[model samples]
Target: MKRFVVCKTCGARVSGLLDSPVALDFITKAEQELLSGGEYGNGDNGNVYISTSDKHHLSYHQDQNRLIGCCGPSPYGLPNLVCICKSEIGREVTDCCTAHYVMLYKERIAIREDNTGLLEKVVSLPVAEDLKSQYEILINFGEIEIVLNALKM
Candidate 1:
């Protein structure tokens, strides 16, 4: 059931964990009301807030000016993260003064399910050298039951 947050503009994977929702402490009463029945980022304006630790495939803004800060990159001003395609993706706030987190613009990203589990399930198999071939066979035939049974053996 793992979900990934991908950049809508370039389809680059940004994070593997989409379970963490924006915490209540950070949102005001008005913002809370706006987010009542739905999760964060469902509307046009709010953002999907996640731990700074969960981010991946994202880099700081190329502009050094945007990254200037005392302990880490400044949390103020503009979005600091960019996709591999170099399109602005989100804001990363990790300076010593603030709580470390990332705010992805809801409109700029989409969620996708991770359904490929063959390699992960077979990773611990004793036959390491043959894993690639076995994986290829499973993918070609679209069968994971063979590997699951092999694990039980």
Candidate 2:
């Protein structure tokens, strides 16, 4: 199975995952937007919901993808990603600026624009019971270094 993660804040070169998720939380909107075309400053201005895959990406790092905008970017922007992970997890992800990531109460679904430029639900992630796990999963820099070395890149 393929796994996805944002770059680590620690000294790790890149972020990878285990068969079990190491991250207790999802990636942040600020990071997600950066992954999308929402660059920090104008090389890029604000509100360019356009998708660009040609942006420079680090080895083993795919900054952007099409047909699947992950659980992050949307035509509505990351600030609007409030309440994503919309699985009733009750983990309150306030990063969406309370814009409701899952509008109409559907988060994991993909909202695509048609030829007429109307956004609609093309597809969505299946609703599943949000697994509540015990114990903490921490990714220390030293552990990350080991994992980075294990990767092909």
Candidate 3:
């Protein structure tokens, strides 16, 4: 039941979900506050943050306007990350005045499920009713296949 963050437009893997999501509250705090003893995920935005080390298959936004930052891209503005297809994906907050992290927008990215590492199931959040059923069927089919293979032994 491992989930991965991926680009919605191109279906490229972004990052493995952090052991614990860096909460939106931590991202909003002043740099000093975060360095002291900041609590994470106490705010309402409910945004998920990831470390740059976990990132892959993503690049900085090509537009200069979206890249503005004292030390890094401003998190308050539009998404600063993009897939290779050049679709807006997420925001990277590394401003000198704030805690540094990457916030992938729920709308621009999707949660992809890694089940058994045999079959990949890409189910977007807020999944449609029909899609949900289809996903279930897929899972069931995979289980059936595993059982059938075991029976062959």
| Distance from true location, Cα of 96 in model 3, Å | 1.2
Q: Give the range of the ten consecutive residues with the poorest summed lDDT in model 3.
A: 34-43
Which residue pairs clash in candidate 2?
82-96, 109-124
Write model 2 residue lDDT over 25-117, tens digit each, in one string: 123443332222221111122111111231111221122331123443343322222122222111111133221121111222211212211
Global fold similarity of model 3 (TM-score): 0.60
What are the lDDT figures for the candidates, one per model?
0.61, 0.21, 0.59
Model 3 scores what on Cα lDDT? 0.59
For model 1, the stretches where C-alpha displacement exceeds 4 angstroms are 20-22, 27-44, 115-153
Leading candidate by lDDT: 1
Question: What's the lDDT for residue 96 in model 1?
Answer: 62
lDDT of 1 at 142: 62
What does candidate 3's lDDT look like per residue over 1-153, in tens digits? Answer: 455667778666676432323335453665523322111222245454566555666888877788898887766788888877788887777778787667777777766666454323323336574654455445545664643353342
Q: List, in order, the clash count of every candidate structure.
A: 0, 2, 0
| Error in Å for residue 88 of model 2 | 21
Candidate 2 ranges with C-alpha deviation above 4 Å: 7-74, 82-139, 143-153
The candidate 1 region of ten consecutive residues with least summed lDDT is 30-39
